[model samples]
Target: MTEFDLIVFGGGTGNRVASAAAEAGMETALIEKGPIGGLCLNRGCNPSKMLIQHATVANRVREASRFGIDASIDDVHFRGFVREVNDELAAVADRKAQDKRDQVNLTLFQEEARFVDDRTIELVESGETHTGEEVVVASGSTPVVPDSIDGIDEVDFLTSADALRLETSPERLVVLGGGYIAAELGYYFDAFGTDVALIDRNETLLHREDADVARAFTEVAEERHDVYTGHSATAVDESNGEFVVTAETEEGGSVEVTGDELLVVLGRRPNTDGVGLDATNIETDDRGFVATDDRLRTSVDGVWAMGDVAGNAMFKHTGDYEGEIVVDNVVHDAGREVDFTALPHAVFTEPQVAAVGRTEAELDKSGTEYVVGRAAFTDTAMSRALKLDRGFVKVLCDLESRAVVGCHVFGHEASILVHEAVPAVRYGLTVDDLANTLLHAHPALSKLVQKACADAVDAADRTTE
Candidate 1:
């Protein structure tokens, strides 16, 4: 048995907690089965975005005729491009591992860890037990693959993780699910000239987004891929080196989509089950996520849970934020409750989508009185100058207080553009407070956000009248 001051499971955002504890002079051990940086670095955000940037460049070149540039993509050399991005990510992961190894008080255990008791963990392969005064489980998440699909076990299919590292773009790709992962990956392959088909049970792509945003994204996706919305995949079969996906349409008819490859991005499940949580007194929710209080402490004393396993939000940014709270509460002994106010997320598909705070549906469901304001990108001179066809922003504010509660955007650079609203949403800035105070540079995309806020002010005033 090896005793440590702290033991951190997972090297994702959990890495932050472990590093901070070690920096604070506590002997710490970080146990990760794979890469040091976990999903975001190895399979999820970082690498996916790097690959999508190539797709973005391809898309721009393909659309350059509209800009009168006469630019064309001669050849993608897709395999080499994918290899380069993956190689770069692997190098970064290596550097991260080496840095952790160099930390004087931190031990890097590149192995799977499982809970033994309330305060003890065992490395699965080594069978070495380590006891900790404090434990943080940031084990992250894994892609969910449903067992309901007939012949699912027999056929070869790619998950979102596999789609990121796929070297050769399939001649035709069938995507299951309509969330951000499916939209982004479907766009990536389509931009690379792959004949992409999207089949989802939801009525629109990005169904969890604001209703208008979902409808708009679904329209844009339809222009690029063979979108089969309101279709549920029933089974998968492979014949003659091609996959045939059978789905039931919303109207109660059967449809088949054949493709050279199939990618499933249904959703993600927490890694709580993998960590041997059942062996300990640690409590997990019905969905298998480790339940934690606002302070991110698990039910067990001296144990904390954050990241996907905590089930607050699955984005990398959310995990990082939770990690900070855990580090402060555990290392410095500060009693800081987790603050998720104005939490934001983005979809990296072409004509990207971004949002902060609550959606109008959420507000309505809660019976919270609110007013909405909307603006098209075309409302701005910058959008016209750039010849953008489809971009929109919607702002929602409290009907009485005028405090900005939610903002949604869909357009080029929507990811970056949405940040301007974050401060307003986080600090409870009113419509007039943001619209009247911020100085948006002329001909900048950010003017779209300003325009939306201005529109919100008008709507709020109208409501009062």
Candidate 2:
């Protein structure tokens, strides 16, 4: 049996933790089942954004006629686009792996790891036993494929993993989920001249978002794709070379959608099961996600769980943030706890969506008194100059304390503008505090946020008067 100061179960975010431990003078080992760089770099965010950016260029030129510019997308060369992103990501993974292998104090185990006991693991491929004084599981997550849909088992379908790797855009693409992944890739293909259809059980495309924002996005999405909301996919079948999906409509009738390819973005499951969690004292919730304290330490002593496996937050930025906390607490013995008071989420689809802090539904469910404010992008000089037709910025603040609790945006660069709301939400700035303190340049998207906040404040002042 080989022993190390620390053994990490994944090389994805574990790469960061392992490197930090080694730098802090502890010998570390990182075991990975897949390639280095993990989901975010290889499959999820980076590569998806790469394709999305190209599609954005195509979409911009296609819409440029609105600005009186003669612009058109002659050819997408989609196969070359996929190849470029994939090859670049692969090179990145290779470089990171080689760098880890070169580290004197960090050993890279290019294999799967399963728990032997509470403090030990077996490298599955080599049958090697390894022990650690401290252990961390950053194994991340995998796409969820349900077997409930009849005939789905036999048909060839693509998930987000496969969608990002396609060299050729399908003649017609059918998407199975209405969340961020489905919205993003569905829009991307639509921009590239591929016929796209979206079928979702939810009534809105981004069901988690506020009703107005969700409605706005669905409206925009409908303009570009065949959107079948409130439809649940029941089964998949193939006729000739095309794929057919039978779904149950909201009104209880059956409908069929035919497409050249099917892309499933229903959801993701944590990579906790089959990881030997049963062998350890590590407790998991009903969803198989590791149950961790605020500090991110697993129930097992000297063990920590983070990223998707821990079920705290699923974003890449969340993983990196928690990884830093884990490194500080374990390596430096800092005793730092995670406070996700202002974590932000963004979907990079056209007319991007972003949100920070508690959603209005949560506030209503809790019976929390709040203020609502809204501003449309069309009211802004910049949006008018750009001839942008849609988008809104909204803010909610506590009625008594005047603290801004939530903010949501739907517009161009909404992802970037959402960050401005983060500090206000995190630090508990009031509507008046934000509206009065911040200086937004004229004709800039930043002013939209201040306008929303000022709207709320003005409404409150009127009520008082």
Candidate 3:
């Protein structure tokens, strides 16, 4: 048995906590079965965005005709392009691992770890036992393939990770699920000239997004791919070198989609089961996520859980935020609550979607009174110059406090533009505060935000009158 000052399971955001402790002169053990950077770097955000950039460039070239520029894509070199992305990412992972190994007080365990007790862990491959004064389980998440789908085990289906690593675009693709992962991956292949069909149980793609944004995105997606909303995938099977998916619609009709490849993007499941939490008597939510207090501490003393395993927001940025909180509490005993206020997320698809804070649906359901402000891209000079036909920004402000509660945007550079509202939502800034701050650049996309804030201020004034 070996003893360490700190032990962290999963090298995702947990790497941050472990590195911090090691730098503090405490012996730290980081057990990561895969690469050091975790899912975001290995398979989730980094790889997906890198590959999506190729799609984005291809799309821009294809759409250049609208700007009166004679642009054409001679060839995509899809296989070589994917290989380059993978090679670059693999090199990054290698560098990360080597850096961690070089850390004076950090031991990088490239092997699986399971809890033997509250503070004891057993390395699976080495059959070695290690105990620590403090432990953090940041086991992240895995892609969920619904067992409810008949023959799901029979037909080989590509997960979000597999889809990102594809060397060649499929002739035709069938995508099951309609959340952000589904939207992003399906759009990538479609932009690469794949015949993509998306099926979802909800009435619209990105149904979790604001209703207006979802509706608008679905309309645009339908123009690019065969979108079958309100349809739940029932079964999958492969025959004669093609895969077929059968789904049941809300109206009780059956629809079958056949494609060269089937991509499943149902969602992600917590890796709670992989870690031996049962031995420690640590509490888990009904959905099997490690239940933690606001400080991210688990039921066991000196133990913490963060990231996807804690069942908070599953984005990499969220995990990073939570990681910082955990380290502060563990090292400095800061006792700070994990503040997810104005947590932002972006979908990297065409006409990208981005949002922060509460959604209109949540406010309405909670019976919270709020006023909305809206602005379309067509109303902006920059958008007109770029020939952008669709996209808009929607902001919701509390009726009483007049502070921005939620902001949703859909447009070119939506991801970047959404930051204008993030500080407002985070600091409880009012619409007037945003609109009256400064002179926005003329004929810029940011004017869309300025216009929306102005509209919000007007809406609030009307509410008082």
| Top-lDDT structure, candidate number | 3
CA lDDT, candidate 2, residue 118 = 87
**Between 1 and 3, whose lDDT is larger?**
3
Please give the RMSD of candidate 1 to the true structure. Answer: 1.2
Candidate 1 lDDT:
0.91
Cα error of candidate 3 at position 109, Å:
0.9
Write the residue-wise lDDT of candidate 2 on 1-465 in tens digits. Answer: 999999988878879999989888898989898889799999999999989999998878878888789986667678887999999999999999999999879999998789979889998889999999999988899988889889988898999989999888888999999999999998788878899999999999999998778999999999999999999999999878899999997688888999999998899999988888889899999988999998999898999988989988889999999999999988998999999998999999989999998888989999988888899999989998988888999998888787889999999999998887899999988999889856677878988889999998977776566
lDDT of 3 by residue, 1-465 (tens): 999988999898899899998998889999999998899998989999998999999998988988789999888799998999888989999998998999999999999889999899999999999999999999999989889999999988899989989898999999998999989998889888899999999999999889999999999999999999999999898999799899998678999999989999998989988778888878999998999999999998999999999998898998999999988998778999988889999999989999998899999999999999999999988888888999999999999999999999998999999999999999999988988867787888987887888899999899899
How many Å off is the CA of 112 in candidate 1? 2.1
Clashing pairs in 1: none
Deviation of model 1 at 84, angstroms: 0.5
Q: lDDT of all the models against the reference? A: 0.91, 0.90, 0.91
Error of 3 at 23 (Å): 0.7
lDDT, residue 343, candidate 2: 91
